[model samples]
Each structure stands twice: as C-alpha cells, then as structure tokens.
Target: MIRAFANPHRFMALSRWLAPACLGVGALLMVWSVWQGLWVVPHDDYQGGDIMRAMFVHVPSAWLAMASYMGLAATGLIWFVWRHELADMAAKSIAPLGAAYTAMCLATGSIWGKPTWGTWWLWDDARMMSVLVMFFLFLGYMALRAAMETRQKAARAGAILAMVGAVNVPLIKFSVDIWSSIHQDASVLRLDGPAMPPVYLTPLLIGGLAHMIFFAGLTMMLMRAEVWGRRGDVLIARKLSGA
Candidate 1:
C-alpha cells in the first residue's frame, strides 16, 4: 500500500480528496473536543483548577511533536532504502510542521507549568529538556537541509540527521520515568491503562486524534504543492534547453 502511492500521480490523485476529508473531520473533532474541554468537562482540583483545560491543546501538541519527528525519520529511512522521491518530499514537509507543533508543545507546556510548577522553565527536568532538544533537532534538520547546495545533498543530509535524531524521541517519552523530574508520569499511555476518567480522557484522546489527522492532511497538501513546484521547475528547464 505504501509502495502503491510512491508514484507522484497516484499520490496527488489520492490526496486531493483524502486531504480535504481529513482536514474537515479533524477540524470538527477539534471543535468538539475543545468545546467539551473548556466548558463541558468538570475540573479536578488535583491537577489544577480551570487551568487543566489547557491539556486539550497541550497534550495533543506534545503527542504530535514526537509523532511528527518519528514520521520524519520513517520517511527519511524510506527514501534512503527505496530511493523514493516522495519520501524525501514528505520529510521536507514534515520538518517545519513538526517544528510548529513542537513550538506549540513548549509554549503551552510552559504556560501550563508556570502556575503549576512555580516556574516558567525547568532546565534540569529530563522530560522538558529532551523535548527542547527534539525541538532543536527539528530546527537543525531544516537548517542542515538549507545549508546544502543541491536537493540531492539536502535530502541526504536531512535524512541522516532525521534518522539519527530519532533516538531522542524515546528519551523524551521515558525521561520522567528514568530520571527524577517534576513532570507527571504516563497517565493516558500506561501499562495499567489511563489514569484519567472518561470525562477528561475522551476529549484529550479526541483532540490528539484531531491533530494527527489534521497534520496528515496538511502534509499531503504541502507535498502536493512540492510536486507541482518540481514539475514547474522541470518545465522551465526544458523550455530553457529548447526541448
């Protein structure tokens, strides 16, 4: 199934409708979850009154930030092994989007943390630091690609960096567990199942799903634009050569 969409034309065809469908559904789900989170759900005094609502947005961004980097690495690996041009395009597209989500994660985490943790940032916290490092990895991947003079070189450089940087993802996930940290341990994704009740967990899960679907749609749209831009470049080159 993955190989079937390796052809640019097939990908374009599939993504045209699929992208919008995902975007629309994701938007609706986002609205529903946000509405439920902000108003419908009751607050727990344990986590933080009213402020816990930010989890609707923050948790999803954190999830996406990690997920997107993994996506970048997976695509980079695909391009490296199969020499798939679309995979390279995907990695390129995912970098900026992943960075955006990572930024959102950091910003929201800080905002949620300031009142809860009594500080704006925690440099010593392993989870926080690991995520910060992932954010830099996203930025570094883009910067490294831009530093290269040619697309082939850019892709090769970006792929290597992305794959290597993927190791940090696990570190981010297990940071709180492996080291002493102020951050809370796994609640939703745990061996003993989610610690949250359905009222809170439902919206959080929905919000996460919404972001992932929305990100996927955005990726397809960006890849589509890249495909058209590459085609235009090819045409321009042909015209200049009088082909």
Candidate 2:
C-alpha cells in the first residue's frame, strides 16, 4: 500500500477526489457534532458540567496531535528507506499541521483547566509537560529542515529527527499512568471500554472522526501543492541554465 502511493500518478488521481470528499464530510460531521454537544447534550452534574464541552475540541486536537506525529514518522520512514518523493512531501507537509494541532490541544486544555482546576497551567503534570515537548519537537524539525540549502539534505535530516522524536508519542499517551499526574486516565480508549456516558461519548467520537478526516484532506492538498511547486522549481532551473 505504501509503495503504491509512492507513484505520483496514482497519488494525484486519488487525491483529486479524495481530498475534497474528506473535507466535505469532515466539515459536515464537525458542524453536526458541535451542535449536538452544545445544544442537545445535557450538562454534567459533576464539576465538569458544561465546561466539559471544551473536550469536543480539546480531545480531538490532542488525539490528532499524536496521530499526525505518527503519520510524520511513517512518511519519514518511507522517505528514509525508499526515498519516495510523495512520502518526503507528505512528511514535510504534516509538520506544520501537527504543530498547529498540538498548540490547539495545549491552549484548549489550559482553558478547560482554568475553570476546573482553578489554574491555567500546571508545570508538574506529566501529560502537560510531555505534550509541550512534543510541540517543541515539531518546531525543531521545521526549523532544522528550513536551515538546509538543499531540499534533499533537509529531507534527510528532518526524516531522521522526526523518527527520533516519535518516542514522545507513546509518552504522551501513557504519561498519566506512568508518572504522578493530575490529568485523568484514558476514558475513551481504555481496554474496559469508554468510561463516559453515551450522551457525551457520541459527540466526542464524531468530533474525533471529523478531525481525522479534515487532517487527511488538508495533508493531501498540501502534498499536491508541494509536488507542483517542486516541478515548477525544476522547470525554472532548467530554463535559467539554458539561457
């Protein structure tokens, strides 16, 4: 499957339709889920209450922050091993989006924490600290890639860096369990099944799906642009050399 997408023609053909389809479906689902969460679902009786609504964005952003990094690792691996053009483009394109998602997750988490915990930020929480590190890794990868003069060299460096930084993904996932943390344990992804009620869980699931699809669509569009942009650069260089 990875090798199949390595072919540019196949990738372009699929992305032409798939990108728009994903964006459309994702946007619709997000609207529906937000409406359901805000207007339809009853507020929690606990301290969380209506404030928990932030989870609609916070949870999905956190999940995608991890997911996008995993994608970066996969594409980076493909580029490192096979030197596939599409894979390189994909890994590069995903970095900024992953960074944006991570930032959103942290910001929204702080917003929720302020009301519930009576504090906007907690330096001691393992989960919080780990995710902040993940965000910095994204920034570092982008900066490192940009500092190189040649795209190939940049890609090589970025791919290696991304793979190495992937260690943070697992840490972010299990940080609450591995160390002392105020963050709640996994509720939606637990082995015993979701710990939350149906009313809250349903919207959360939809929101997660929406974020995943939107990220896919956005990533594909960026990959397509990178391919074209690279081709244009090659053409310009050839013309200049001829002149």
lDDT of 1 at 5: 72
How displaced is residue 14 in candidate 1, in Å? 0.5
Computed on alpha carbons, the lDDT of every model, listed in order, comes to 0.86, 0.86
lDDT of 2 by residue, 60-80 (tens): 999999888889998999999
On lDDT, the candidate that comes out on top is 1
User: Candidate 2 — which pairs collide?
Assistant: none
Clashes of each: 0, 0
TM agreement with the true structure for every prediction: 0.90, 0.90
Clashing pairs in 1: none
Q: Provide C-alpha RMSD values for all models, in order.
A: 3.5, 3.6
Badly placed stretches (over 4 Å) of model 2 are 168-194
Q: Which digits, one per residue and each the tens of the lDDT, describe model 1 over residues 1-243?
A: 778979988899999999899999999999999999999999867776788898999999989998899899999999998989999999999999999999999999888777667677866566567778888999899999999999999999988888787765676558644654444442222213437888998999999999999999999989999999999999999999996
